[model samples]
Target: MLRRNLPSLFRFSSSASASKPVNEEKSRSVGRKAVSTALFCLTGGVALSALDDLAIYHGCSSKAMEKASKNQEVVHAIGEPVVKGPWYSASLAVAHKRKSVSCTFPISGPQGSGVLRLKAVRSGDDSWSTFFQSRDFQILILDAVLYVPGNEETQRNVKINIADNIPSPSSQACTRCPETRSPGKQ
Candidate 1:
């Protein structure tokens, strides 16, 4: 019995003092701390990048669109506002040689949104350009016009209506317009 238990005793004794030398243990601990810190920083950077992308996706909100429409120049220049990824687009109509003409708005989104960055760049001798940049930081150009109804200020700013033109008929005038006859007269 004594011989059999001797091996068990040795195993117990080896397990009892597993601590390494003081200096070696301290160095290992410091290395682990460094690794932990680096991992934390990397994770934080990734999270911030994701938040920026999300903020850019929302684009311009209802209020900004209203304000732009109120001003005659902005209204006339206002082209299509696009909702693609992290960019919303609108154009500005400004006189040539104007130092600067642009409208910027704030973006609201899933986490920590930011102000939109708008700018007008000279496209050609005859053309002026405008763009809207999202928080995720991308630029888009205007291609179509968004229409709204009612002249009232209350209704003007509100996006109650949006006009989406139908695609050109396969053949010219192929589709019929709605009947104009009065309900009872018809």
Candidate 2:
């Protein structure tokens, strides 16, 4: 009778050990899943960064640079074909829903270097526009702040308006603002 009880005790112990292995296997699988998820998220973020860089390289920034480069005033302040600086030295602000952008970038030429400030708005609601769309930014206002090295204020370092698309002073009438002067109103 004692021997029969011993076998039964051994059987119960074996079943308990088997359940522990199953629990361990489940915990390992959960850990592996967590690591895989983290890796996927990291890769997605890296891809988006690469995409933004590519867009900045070939999109609205380039177009704004082209417009600024073409201006005679900008050319005189900086240099002709006003390009050739590192890409990382620019600031970009994008208004997602309103489809507007404000950009400031460093520009240099044979004579000197300056900062370009530009504000632009998309002409129409485009079907393919996302956060970083660059194709439709019509430049509304462009200004170049030149920094003249080894010269006086008269020689350089003045802000030049490259392009202006603001409303004419004669038509600025916002009834809500009491300080705003309108046409035919003092």
TM-scores across all candidates?
0.29, 0.65
lDDT of 2 by residue, 28-140 (tens): 99999999999999999999766865574456677778877767766776667688466678777767654677878888887788888888776566454654665556888
User: Deviation in angstroms for 71 in model 2?
Assistant: 0.9
Span of 10 residues, lowest total lDDT, candidate 2: 163-172
- Cα-based lDDT at residue 12, candidate 2: 100
Rate residue 171 of model 1 by lDDT.
Answer: 23
Model 1 residue 70 CA deviation (Å) reads 16
Clashing pairs in 2: none
Task: Write down the lDDT of every candidate, Cα atoms only.
Answer: 0.40, 0.73
Error of 2 at 44 (Å): 1.1
Top candidate on TM-score is 2
